[model samples]
Target: MRSMPNTNTRNLHELSADIAAVVRDVVATGEDAVITDDGTEVAVIMSMADYDRLHLYAELADAARPGYAGATEFRAMSISEMLDVLGVHPTVDRGLRG
Candidate 1:
């Protein structure tokens, strides 16, 4: 008794020439593009399954971080610091490893 997922539509202009790069996002977001000629809509493209999946993920993300606006700052860390934070053992046996 699985219900069919809802589909979303988008305009052709919204799609990028390098869509393959963002195929995953496009599918998950339930977003797509409608090709148009002159003033008439020609075709529609989208990933119903992907859109539903992405939408659900987005809802979960929002629920997980309630009241969090968004990313504010971007910081770069050194390789040693990143490894330490991740508890990853450095492959290179550098005696001076952090």
Candidate 2:
């Protein structure tokens, strides 16, 4: 979805009163409204799905980096060897497995 670029910056007190309206607009328009504190960017209001997707993508990106925890080490294995190690037998006649 295309998002509108309208952003609302506010102090803590004004933000408390209008946060609901800002969040509603973000959800309705699939956009993020920036919230600031003491002239520094503090938070953003966005659609839940968009936020989740961005968060998941960041996690995946981090997981894809070298030395990331729980990252799969596949450089030393052939496809057939990987499948065998994973206990997945290939039923089809494809050249690659796993």
Candidate 3:
């Protein structure tokens, strides 16, 4: 989904009166509709596809920052090794046998 710089504005009453129509327009054009109340923007409506794409972009950006990396690797390890990595002690017997 692409970013829509040009947005349409609808007053609260107008949105409430014909919500389906407004939402249809938004989905059809892929443009956001700003819902305003008392001349102040209160909310926005956009298509689910656009919202998901935007959310993914934000997640990627957050992961790109230092110390914000996500867990993308997996490996098998022993219980003791897992405990050591977690910085904790195993107080109960895990029933592991050699």
Tens digits of per-residue lDDT for model 2 on 1-98?
Answer: 12223455557657888778777777776556777677776667767775665456555555555786875663554434544544445453333211
Cα lDDT of candidate 2 equals: 0.58
The TM-score leader among the candidates is: 3
Residue 66 Cα positional deviation in candidate 1, in Å, after optimal superposition:
50
Tens-digit per-residue lDDT, 1-98, candidate 3:
22225478889987778999999888877667988889887788978875775456455544554565565664545434544554434443333211
lDDT of 2 at 64: 58
Show where candidate 3 strays beyond 4 Å. 1-4, 70-98
What is the lDDT, from 0 to 100, of the residue 7 in candidate 2?
51
What stretches of model 2 exceed 4 Å from their correct place? Answer: 1-6, 70-98
Model 1's alpha-carbon lDDT is: 0.47
Residue 41 C-alpha lDDT in model 3:
77
Per-residue error at 30 for model 2, in Å? 1.3
Q: How many clashing pairs in candidate 3?
A: 0
When 1 and 3 are scored with TM-score, the better candidate is 3
Clashing pairs in 2: none
Least accurate stretch of 10 residues (summed lDDT) in model 2?
89-98
